[model samples]
Target: MKLELPQRDVGLADDFSRSEPLRYLNLFRLTLAGLFLVAGPSLHLGSDSPTIFFGVSFAYVAAVLSFGFPDAARLLGHNRLVTVQVLVDVTSLTLIMWASGGYRSGIPILILIALAGAGLVGQGRMVLFYAAYATVAVLLENMFRLLSGRETVDFFTVGITCIGFFAIAQVARLLALRAIANENLARQRGVDLASQLRLNRQIIQDMQDGVLVVGEGGVVRQFNPQAVALLGAELREGATLGEHAPALERELRRRAEHGDSAHSLRADGSGKMLLARFLPAGEANETLVYLEDFDRIHRQIQQVKLAALGRLTASIAHEIRNPLASVYQAAELLREEKRGDMQARLIRIIGNNAQRIDRLVADVLALGRRDEALPEALPLAEFVDEFIEEFDVAESGARGVVVNRVPPGLEMAMDRAHLRQILWNLVGNARRHCSGAPAAVKIDAALRDDGRVALDVSDDGPGIAEALRAQVFEPFFTTHSKGTGLGLYISRELAEANGAVLELCVTPPAEAGTTAALPGAHFRIIGRVKP
Candidate 1:
């Protein structure tokens, strides 16, 4: 996985180190300056020492003003300005040390404090520079005091003090470097965490199953788009879940108290059988609910069952066909051998029954291979003209087949074999049932508003009853006693495999002035027009 770190703030570590330590340094300066006024007399400093104290106090007041005004710091710019301030501090402390009697006074410790502040400025070279400068000044003062006979200096004390200043500077610089590294690691971690959160949200939003997180009192804390669609309600965050889906909210709340549970229930209005699963989430009274449409699952299972049945029958059908062909040949030979009238009639019946059985076997074998359909564009006008001509030749003396005018240049995407099989079933059914003499059955085509072409096969017989409309597409449903009953079902399956629909259409209502156009059975094949 790729990690994208957040952008680092420019100079954040440097600015932080520079400003933070300066605040403390200013406080130290003020406190030390106050101590000089309060304890100068006890140390027995002469009047000249007071002048030095006053000067240091005045310099500190200017430092206080600089700290209070942001623009002053911006004008001086941190590095150059801080360097000047540190120099002032070193010079002031040296003077204070001298006035307080050199090595005898404990004020030299303030020089060490300055060195520590320099380390917090995040500049290692500057710290060393200041430390060396302070060391030289101290040594010079000690030498001057000793040589001028002002006071005796302890060389060991001066040497130890210089070492202490450099030590403090080195240790502080190491800590500053470590702090900056920690800050960078923490910033990168925050960026990765945010990226992971957004990725998880996208995955949840795109899920097919509905997901919901309901908090206390049935308030919807979080929900995905699928939840809104599956529930058939618009779910806004922070809205009470009970308002949109009361049954689901109640089920979730009940399961939250009673441990993990799953319920299969039908949603009202939508009539979708849903499998709802609830699990406890986080702390307190919260639950995660998952909703899935059980009807879709049932359909998938049914399709698998149908496919298995098709495979089993395919093997059985091939074996049965060979025996059936032998039986049909025997019946035809027996009729030709001039048996008695009753025996001849029985042979004809046997022949007809064998033919019907052969037809059924062929349909069953076709079912096993119905899933594959290689489609191509077929121009509707030309296809229909060729089909009617071939159908008339196949039907031999049958009459009254008429084709209505179709839209020009209309085309359909379909497998030629599949489309021919479906149209043959529809036209055959219409021809077998049609009652009229001159125009018993008809074929027509039109363009529908939803970007599909509708090819209609209608007859002039009584239309199917309203109660039987829903079952017309079902397998093994037939009105004819001699029919195999798999014709419409196989046709529909083939149509669907080719990205088309075969459905019953309502016959147009008769006009008040005429009984010439009576109701009839109408079926339509709806399919996409090829680009």
Candidate 2:
């Protein structure tokens, strides 16, 4: 990821460029002004042209004020501004030396300061350029003084001063480059730190367990979205935890004082069990808490157990097949031979029970090897109507016992074989349990508001007891003695595999609508509807 540094009105290098030269020049100007003002007989310093020196000092003050204006100061931008200030310093110092004492004046050394500042502000060859200009201006001023017969030229002093300017420029340039390098290095570090902080926050927010940091006084400092979901309440920063979760706050304090590492508590009103861990967050009073739902973990464990059982059952069923076929063949042979009346009846019973056991085995094997669904869009209303017709003809004695109320043109996407098996099991159960001519067995199908196809198979018989409702879909759980018990379990598994929901709904109250008053067992299947 690219590092993003914090922004500022002025950049580091640019601010250093303009501010350094301006600062040094202002100091030089003010110092010269002060010297000229105070240097006289009273200060034990005398000047040949004190009046001209004072006038030049006043002009320097005016130049300082002019550059102080916002528009004028920034007119040439940062880099150009620094260069201009250096040039002005050289010229002003040259004139000041002429006014003081021609070539012999010590003020010519002050020009070196301006050239050194240029080295700091400007880079590379520009440093040499500024030094060259300063040297030339000083020589010209001294030449003018000598030609006018004010003083004689001193060749040795001029040559040494000019060499000093170049030496100072090179030294200042090296220092400036080092300082810039340090600033750039520090800026990059800041950017990297910011990027790391962002990445850490993302990882914390996406964690599966809910996390919270709470102060000792119960105020919430931070919380993840999962914490809100698990607690069934919003946790705002700076808000008292007692307002949202009193039980949780009490538990947190208890765990910390007793030196416990973790605690489990149920959320108020929600009845969701949360396992929480308390860790000190590098502060004496602040605590970082992680919460995870106990029910979710239990459910995951339960699924793993069920999967193991399924594999075991598949292995056992394969072993039973060989012995079961042998028993069926022996029973069939006994029924074909002549026998006494009681013996004949016993043989028939054996054959009938053997066939029932065989069918049970077949169903169990089918459950073990259920095919993956290759779903297709189907007109549900038409499909159910056809199924009811076929079922009526197949079950001769159960004619007119099944009723359907599916609206025409309704559609759903489902595996045809899986759908057929699920519907057959539910409708057959309804048919077997019904006791009247009006047919309490009914298939109710409709398109729900949320774009799902809802199909409910309900009966008008006695409803399932609350105690047994929980186990209705469990494998090998059946109220009937002859039932294999894999029917509802396999049906639910198929429904889930196809991304559908199959649930046992509450039987409607007697005072409610007609369907509710029937008080039958209702199994509702909801799945995505095809457009």
- Cα-based TM-score, every candidate: 0.53, 0.51
lDDT of 2 at 173: 78
Q: Give candidate 2 regions above 4 Å deviation.
A: 1-46, 101-109, 138-161, 188-192, 195-199, 202-207, 303-531
Report every candidate's CA lDDT.
0.75, 0.75
Query: Given candidate 2, what's the lDDT at residue 210?
Result: 90
Candidate 1: list runs displaced more than 4 Å: 1-18, 34-48, 234-239, 268-271, 296-531
Per-residue lDDT of candidate 2, residues 1-531 (tens digit): 333323421233566544755576667666765665666234422255666666766766666556645566557676666666667677767777777676566666677777776777675676788889888988897788778888756867887888898999989877876676566667788888999999989988898889999997999999988888888887899998899988899998798679998999998735799998988888878999999999989999789969977875785475456546756665766667566775676566666667657757766665655557867788877888888888878787555677767778877778888888889888877777666566577777778899898888888878888999999997767887556677788889888867788888887224224553667788988998752
Error of 1 at 465 (Å): 62
Q: Report the lDDT tens digits of candidate 1 across residue range 1-531.
A: 433333542333367646876777767767776666676657664333567666765665566556535575688777766677777778877777776677667667888887787777635477788888889889987897788788756889799989988889888766766666566667778899999999999999998888998888888989998887778877888999778887787677667667658987666435677889987787688878899988778889899988968865664565456657767776766757765876767677677767678777777766656777888888888887777777789885444555545566888888888888888888888878877466567777778899888887888777899999998876667898667777898899898888899888777324348876557888889998872
TM-score of 2: 0.51
Instruction: Give the winner by TM-score.
Output: 1
